[model samples]
Target chain A: MSTRRLIPGSAELRAEFPILAREVHKRPLIYLDNAATSQKPAPVIAKLVECYERWNANVHRGVHKLSEEATEHYEGARAKIARHIGASDPAEIVFTRGATEAINLVAQTFGRTRLAAGDEVLITALEHHSNIVPWQMICRERGAVLKVVPITDAGDLVAGAFESLLTPRTRLAAFTWVSNALGTVNPVVEMTALARARGITTLVDACQAVPHFALNVRSLDADFLVFSGHKVYGPNGSGVLHGKRALLESLPPWQGGGDMIASVTFEESTWNHVPHKFEAGTPDYPATVALATALDWLSALGWDAVAAHEHTLLAAAEEALGAIQGVRLIGTPAHRSGVLSFTLDGVHPHDLGTVLDRMGVAIRAGHHCAQPVMDRLGVPATARASFSVFNTLEDVAALAAAVRETKRLFGA
Target chain B: MNDLDDLYQEMILGHARQPRNFGALAPCDRSAKGHNPLCGDRVTVYLRMDGERVREIQFDGAGCAICTASASLMTDGVKGLARPAIERVFQDVHELATGKSDGSKDLGKLAVFSGVSAFPMRVKCATLPWHTLLAALDSTSAPVTTE
Candidate 1:
């Protein structure tokens, strides 16, 4: 296929997702909440159907042709994801339920074995609870301290405070490559490099980054990296966890079940090798293949063009929202992804969100499961809109138009 | 602009604009902070009762019009009623808002929030203050669950 742009045009982009074909309160649906979860494209849905129709079987234990084919497809998905992220070895990648589970696996297995009392783990203010809560649980259990790196008012990480927090006792530094709440694309390459010099484990929750930007874990120097499949137009209940070979080899198995054991006995049992060791039970066979197909499609649309398309939407939205009176945009960092969070002076976010929904413009309006970030911003809640490659300038305009109508209705 | 078509009614806007009995009471006997995590609706209910008679009730917080108006009306609903009667009123208001109990419902201007139940997502916004007032009657730290 020729390297044509994903945004054939605003109308063309709007036609891809069949969900957008539906009406909301008799108005056209303008979904702008990609940050929460994106609508799956037709190709991704077709891939799901194809997996069930042709390649459906239990993987890795049967010598039958069907099982062999299913195993091959599952492993093929692993390879596709590994290649997409520039992962050096396919064995470095492990299939997980989603990014949340992948992060939990590291915290449970690695944290249980590698860390102990007085050891500290550093996380940032920008993390979703998925990243923060798991580490907090592990730290509390293992008698380790959890340190939080603050962020500037502009939504940029307070680099100086982060540097100051680093100590010899610090065992790991986990942060998002791009924040899901605020769109700040954290400089993980610099962050990982700094941690490595101090012999600290560097973890990157790249669920938000892998969807919108090009990434190479080797270049970023991340000891562990994770991204979810659903957010990238793949099927749900699938994710990828990439870890350095030596590090994965050292950690113990997280769950005990089928496909993770080499041999089992009444008394003793042995575990499977690296990637297989982490993947327990019957894996999500069809969803895994679809995730790989989605990644393949994203690869075909080169990151540069994809990034440019998303930037266009973000620029359009920022300019339009700024022009409206009493509208304040949160997370105005110089470097950000396409997510936009904002508040109007007199309108409650709940009421504002309700108005937006009735107008067929869907945006997230709440704490977004990141209450800490909300507290930091001094807002009880704010309405949020996130963009993706499929979105266009027109969608941003719909959001602005909806906000203005809300202001008018509320007499703000 | 009379737009009942808007999610908020005039009573809701009025309460939000000039909230009656708004602000913290003087060293209240019972107080509890109730927060709706989803919408960030928060209300602190302060009550001072004399024996079985309700003396005073006040509240303060950041919330949507539904919650603010509900808080404002809640004070009026239980001001003259006794303790047992107040509890019954709580039940009656809950039943009325949820469409269980109708005629003779002493909901007052809270009747405006009857439209809110249609939007399931906004239900908590209307009930946040009621939950806070429930807590303020007699409770300790840590949020008390209504559902």
Candidate 2:
């Protein structure tokens, strides 16, 4: 099926984007590296422009109209995001630079309060370095132990590994909802459910999942969910952290700065309420506004339509890529989103990427910030083409075409 | 600039597949590991020095074509050269490849990599072996590692 009109569904609107409307390398830009970052739609760009042009005031302190407007828009964006992720109250959401910082915030703050010297932190084999490193940093500082839950040969987190790793000393479990490297849609719901049953707090890095699928925090039963806005067609510096209010309230404010504290004195200072306590300095107000607009754009596209279109593209990609000799797909789970990571014989991924770039096709080729995932999959690096709402079956053909070209060039 | 021929010049690919003096020297003297985390390029260079001269040079690892081919050329060029002369070879390679050494150096097979410096990202892949050469010379019995 010709999916050019289906994926982004922006036939009526995408022309408004000055960037996408132009030609790249004399060809229509087919952006398949959505996992690296998705291009912002026109509405998000407009929202960014609106924030800078009209409501250009620092939030939370002023009584004047512009300040009030700025604060309202800022907090309103939070509410929109809260609603987007099935959060009951805006207080449950905190703004972060991106999911990496959000994850670090939890690891540093919550890990400090809940974990002891001997406590163990559980993370899966497929987590991004962002998810893995912060906890390692906190553990190294606090003398707590870090335990990795291994994955199966097929790249699923070995279900039993977590059970054995979960001791009474286990403090928290954090892992990705869907792996960025292997495109493995982890059974995080079942895994998180199990973690919670063992009295271990669970954190899910939903950066890859939330942008592609509908998310209900209650259904996932995760204590904390983190995702970046940029991956969801929003601004780069904005991200969301959805936590249970009780869990959020119990942790100390992560970064000491303005907005996070209600009052400060030389003698003693008390913290602000739940969300703001974590939102330290002046937030990325423009990016946050743009994030809400991106959400609105996605919602208007509708999940059922987006999922249907993506499934078509992904299936075609799998079949076409499988037909090529020496092409190995990383995650082969029955359930997956549209992210595909593969390796071709006798061609370095960077060489493959450079050849594809020459043809005006873009794909991510590297360790994908998941070296451990690369290690698990027994590949040095991979070339990945991730689909967003804007991608089409044509993008799949583009990927296959690029691989064929790469094979020809590499004498494979 | 010279057609993508600058990238896959026959010499570059030929050396990449059949790297000279590759594998390990028997009962090695000094060796080091060079790692490129960006592309996961790794190589262990083996050197056996007869007094101040490098009598034998060898390498074994997995890396991109540029790294492997450059390394292969490097071992061939440095054999029988004194430590100071080998150091001169390092400078000459850097000059020819990085556009620093007056551009008149007849690098033979190494000039195939000069186009790599133009790409910027591949410069390290081309220079990794030479960088490991310095580290291997100093780091005692344990292999010196460079990134």
Candidate 3:
């Protein structure tokens, strides 16, 4: 097959990720699971190793030189993440374990404070379990109902469903910028704007979106936005929650710990500033620095090139897989990212995934933590192949070939 | 195909395509549900007990080849057996599926599951039905999870 170039420098960029060069099952790895967690590049890995070897110290409280440098690096990551998400103030960025924790932090603090009995929290059917369960927990505790906006069979959010559900009892609307299971890029800007017009707060789960393109949370005007570091080729346990500073300041702290406190007595205590109060404990300093390095790398690549390369991979895979005799593509939303979830006739997703693994094509299979979407689509699970900047047309071809092989094994 | 032949053997595939006892039993005396949330595999085992013996046993659900086939084989292996006899078969099958023991001669057709121990992640799939059987025997309603 002839190689097709989408981005000018993407070929060279692929070399930056060392893991891409390795072999799996005696064949060169065709890493297509980027939507799950991207493989880290050399610079991001180097930054993590450098942090531990050069300056390993706790942040915010230590008086020594190593402590001051560690504090600088950690806070610098906070600033870099703030700018990456288009937040105006660094104080609005709070580091959490990942996107799940970020959403839970908002649900526990903001959801607890604002929501009252009979209030409603709205989300779409396209949500991952992380986006759904946290609100379910908070709403259950607060006597609030959880309302779901319907989606069309094409996996697009239903037009007017958002507005129809935006009743007076609706206190908050939290939804994903992109569906992890379906790859449907949601119209979050219009959804957030509609919710804001109705005086309801909004939070956007950009965990799938932030990796593919540049996101301007301020431009979207959502009260809160979140993304995971690992999904963007950074270290695990690194994530950022960006909130409007005024909104964050008014919400009470969720978890109490050493760093989140400004003053403490036996009977009385005062909380720290907005970000620190939400952070609660000692943060993963090295991972945060590596996350910033990842942002710097993506910023250098620019969103245009990243999206172009990924779209080429997605389009190629879609065409090739859709042409196969028994392959049924799960979602073909009008607007989508690089995720492709599909099923082969007579082949269970687990069986397909096992066969693909032997061919050195790593893909995700199962409900993808979006059982509602799977139920809506009338499937138990799907085999999903998500593309990233480093993925090429060859990778898509390999995936299509492996899928064909899976069909053959099932005598299809 | 050669690499996965051990996992999706012809016998397993045949059973998956046509699983035995793949329906709910009416007048079922005991029943329990088993679910593997990771893969969305769910099975509800129903048993009709005549005193301490199982008169009829069946399972109804959706799962991968290994899971469905295992449940099919399990009902065939344990039906009409007394409580203690079924318990003994369960122990032998568990050991075989988990690589703890080679096939016992008494286990008869259940020896096909010995290949399951090679794939660690799949061991749970092969044993989910057996666990659900135990749950049914104990008359517990809580769903078992192979996390």
Best by TM-score: 3
What is the C-alpha lDDT profile of model 1 across A106-143, one tens digit per residue? 99998999889999999999899999999999999999
Which pairs of residues have clashing backbones in candidate 1?
Answer: none
Ranking by lDDT: 3, 1, 2
Question: lDDT tens string, model 2, A172-287?
Answer: 99989888887888888888888888888999999999788889887888999999999998999999889999999988888999998989999988899989998878999989
Off by over 4 Å in 3: A1-11, B103-106
**Model 3: how far residue A121 lies from native, Å:** 0.5
Candidate 3 per-residue lDDT over residues A269-352, each given as its tens digit: 999998999887888999999999998887677688888877877888889999999999998899999699998887778878
- Give the DockQ (2 decimals) of all models: 0.59, 0.47, 0.70
| Model 3 CAPRI rating | medium
Q: Going through the candidates in order, what is chain B's TM-score?
A: 0.84, 0.89, 0.92
Worst 10 residues of 1 chain A by lDDT: A1-10
> How good is the docking of model 1, by CAPRI class?
medium
Model 2 misplaced regions, further than 4 Å: A1-18, A22-27, B1-3, B82-88, B95-102, B140-147
